[model samples]
Target: MAILIPFGLKMQAQNNTSGNKILVVYFSHTKNTKEIATQIQQLTGADLFELVPSRDYTTDYQALIEQAKKEINADYKPPLKNNLQGIDQYDVIFVGSPNWWNTFAPPVATFLTSHDFSGKTIVPFITHEGSRMGRSEADMKKLCPKATFLKGLPIRGSSVKEAKPLVERWLREIGVMK
Candidate 1:
């Protein structure tokens, strides 16, 4: 005999919670940052949005870094694929990205600059090889001047799955979960 469960209920059971309205926006180059975002979504039940670059970066790591440096140096704001509607509906905005050249990824910069996050609780999470949050925390402060910036979680890209404890701690810090 086979037992069947409602698909919707199964999905709902896998999510963290629906009590809190949260949004998770992230920029991932080689899927490192995306892994972190997925974990946060699991822990917070936040709606997820990918912060994609209008132009894909070069495949060569060093070339990509150099190109990213140029964009950051120029303070460029590349266009995003989609914009979050009803952003004000979310009580918390969890932004994620891979640290590039000691700062948040350029596409994430574009997303933050383009949106008005005033009065929102802005939480940042970053994955990096070694820099660890670097200048991202301060940079987010400047970008979302009107939003409440919470202390963020920084995890090594290679250790993303192992960061569940830290992510839960951060969620608790923000009062998202017990």
Candidate 2:
């Protein structure tokens, strides 16, 4: 039984403008994070992009865990597809990913490193079983030292549908949507 909730006043309060160029980028293995990204796109008319690894992870849960662990332990930066051409056009970037070992997915890390975010604002949205943003906010600052990293929103992977309002509220606070 999936649940869906609309963005309420808290979200609307954050909407100070009617037009903003927002970009929502994420990488999902189980579709949980992607679903959240979709909702954000729908409300804000933000452009969306899914990070795809050069090689896909195995479908077996245990095998995927092992692979993720190895990458996290080694601080690996997996190769990513050539990013969206001219992604720099956006005013703000909303980065999303599933938490793996208390950090952003390796592919997302790869994408972060590949781009230059000199003066852009970055808002992180993470989905996890338990661990939330983990070290991702700090990691993003490290990766894009020139960009402004804002407060992040962390949601449970099991409660994504209930997250629409919260997600909208966040975008409003960050001045990404109206």
Candidate with maximal TM-score: 1
**Per-candidate clash tally:** 0, 0
Worst 10 residues of 2 by lDDT: 1-10
> Which lDDT values do the candidates have, in the order given?
0.79, 0.79
User: Which digits, one per residue and each the tens of the lDDT, describe model 2 over residues 40-116?
Assistant: 77767666788888888889989998999999889798876546667677767888999988889999888888888
Identify the runs in model 2 with alpha carbons over 4 angstroms from their true place. 1-19
Report clash pairs, candidate 1.
none
Error of 2 at 45 (Å): 1.3
